[model samples]
Target: MQLAQQRRAFIMETVRRDGAVRVAELVERLAVSDMTVRRDLDALAARGLVEKVYGGAVAAPGTRVEEPGFDAKTALAGPAKAAIAETAAALVEPGSVVAVSAGTTACAVAARLLDVPRLTVLTNSLPVAELVRSASRDRGEAAVPTLLLTGGAPTPSAALVGPLAELVISSLHVDLLILGAHGVSEEAGLTTPNLAEAQTNRTLIGAARRVAVVADHTKWGTVALSGFAPLDRIDCFVTDAGMPASGREVLADTVGELLVAGAE
Candidate 1:
């Protein structure tokens, strides 16, 4: 067991330093048989420390696998998130049912949704649920939107996830789903570090007719551990004008409708 542990650690370090590790190189360095090296690589891939390719393994995308808590995430790119949220909120029509996933950007979007009369919201985010509920109360009886929250274990991001959330989302459908992501890329699509949240987000997507992803410029080119939807699955994408020209060009060709949010 000690030998195996040391081998895996060495493999991970090599991949980290070089960005990838070939099977032949690992076999030679470890002085092990080809089969033994392959087994070690397989074990590392399963743990998500590296991504297995045709001939070798490369480092997985994203800065880290573990996600930061809600407060930490909310503090980053606050202005950009607010601007994107405002633009995304404009898409919700009166009486439309909207599903909101967990993320700082989604919470911002929920804050802007109060003006839409007769809107019904379902959410897996505790912050989003509370915001909508409070906003509904402030709106009085005329514009009070019905709010529903999924019952499940709460993540560090305050998202209700697990089987209970998926079960509830599976039975209902919504007009739109406002989703947030840890990372977005042409290859990885929409991704998050928490696997359970990924499954919960997928259910949210399955329950919605249209999917709108709200992300800031920082998310581009990042890839998280679990992917919930393909890039083509997004019906609309709203981001701040700070998005890089290279990303904008790629997104313009791939996404359905790319809308850049300006400072408002």
Candidate 2:
């Protein structure tokens, strides 16, 4: 098991650095059989970490948190994200204020908020803010949701972060924070690759009474550079049922509640 994990990690790192990996190269570098290399690549592909090509694997379509644009991310986790978002949207009551962190899954959650009237949403994601804006425009005055955006430098992921975003979040409190992450694990918790986004996410957590994180099962076991909080910090976690059984068990024990959104 340890050896498999090490090989998988090495493969991911190699792919991230080179943008792609050939089966022959990995087999030679790791001194493993061709079949072994293929098996490892298959595992990574199953987790959405790599995209298998004809003779090798390329970095998955939305593997890199710091570089994947909003459209790329939305395409990667379509059904799972929609299911998780629908489950998370149920947590918001009409007339309640909510803060959402940047992520594809969280964007889906933002999309669902349009149906709930009298909602006020605070966000650091330009895509999410615009989604709310377009929805409000379509719904007209009576049912429109109030949208507020934080000012800061925008990252490739469409998140606005830095001191300015933090300052604005610190002053306001909301009913819940619909947080997103590069990955979530028992040890690393909610984490992101960008340090500035990490700082702003911490502030968002503080500004909320209840925290509900929306992540797909693919996020399991992946750890990014900066961790914003521990597992216990979240009041609720919403994820798809596709999560590995072991991960589901561990997450349920750590989070206040683990809401599993079905795949179909």
Candidate 3:
């Protein structure tokens, strides 16, 4: 079972690397039977990692299986992320406890939160904790003195995700959760390719009184490997103006509130 999981991970990586992968190629590369490669591709496709094509598979359209570096994600959808972050931050109340999930957009939300007075933040994101800590130093310890960091195994995106992180997250509750995702879709709702991250995110969702998902327009229709929440589970969906009217309509109907940030 463990070996199968590892092989599936390798196949997912291959599809991500070249945008598509052939069953014959995998058979040759892994010294596995054609049946074995087909089964692996089937499993990956079922998990929304790849799309099975003729004699091959392609990365799921507009979605990804491999986690990108934090800096790389930060470079994407810059204007949209800024706008989404500002809009999402507006949901925070002064002097309230908030939980932030890990991602570049979540870090942006964390940065926007500095002006709020005496806010205590609980987060599994290393970048978010670092950002808040630096801000506190600049303004004095009293500015935002209470930033809780969960210690766990780190993900590729600089997030502490695993059993240790989930254990800490499960014991605490916050007023709101500003969550980020590797991808979002009508089918998957909220998802990440990293299974551990998905588990950690599920814990974060349970710990929060209200959940707000922050995603750029590009995330629409993208589905990752593991889904933590369906659309109805989200309390609010905050996105940028780049979202089309059709997407906006669907979100407004499905989520509690759909807030779109204007041009940055």
Measured against the true structure, the TM-scores of the candidates, in listed sequence, are: 0.80, 0.75, 0.87
Error of 1 at 183 (Å): 0.4
Worst 10 residues of 3 by lDDT: 1-10
RMSD (CA, Å), each prediction: 5.9, 8.5, 2.8
User: lDDT by residue for model 1 over 29-140, one digit each (tens)?
Assistant: 8888888878988876764557889888888755345678999999999999989988999999999999989999999998888778788889999998888777657766
Among these predictions, the greatest lDDT belongs to 3
Comparing 1 and 3 by TM-score, which wins? 3
Best candidate according to TM-score: 3
- RMSD to native, candidate 1: 5.9
Residues 127-190 of candidate 3 have per-residue lDDT tens digits of 9999888877788778763899988999889999888999999999899999998887776788
Off by over 4 Å in 3: 2-10, 18-43, 46-48
Once fitted onto the true fold, the runs of candidate 1 whose alpha carbons sit more than 4 angstroms away are 1-62, 136-142
- Residue-level lDDT of model 2, residues 1-264, one tens digit each, is 239867876787788688889999988899999999999988877656678999999876545534567777788878999899999999999999999899899988998888787889999999999888777688775676788898899987899999999999999989999999888877668877676888899999999999999999888887664579899898999999889999889888899999999945
CA shift at 51, candidate 2, in angstroms? 22
Task: Determine which window of 10 residues in candidate 1 has minimal summed lDDT.
Answer: 59-68
> Candidate 2, clashing residue pairs?
none
- lDDT of residue 136 for candidate 2: 64
True lDDT of residue 12, candidate 1: 66
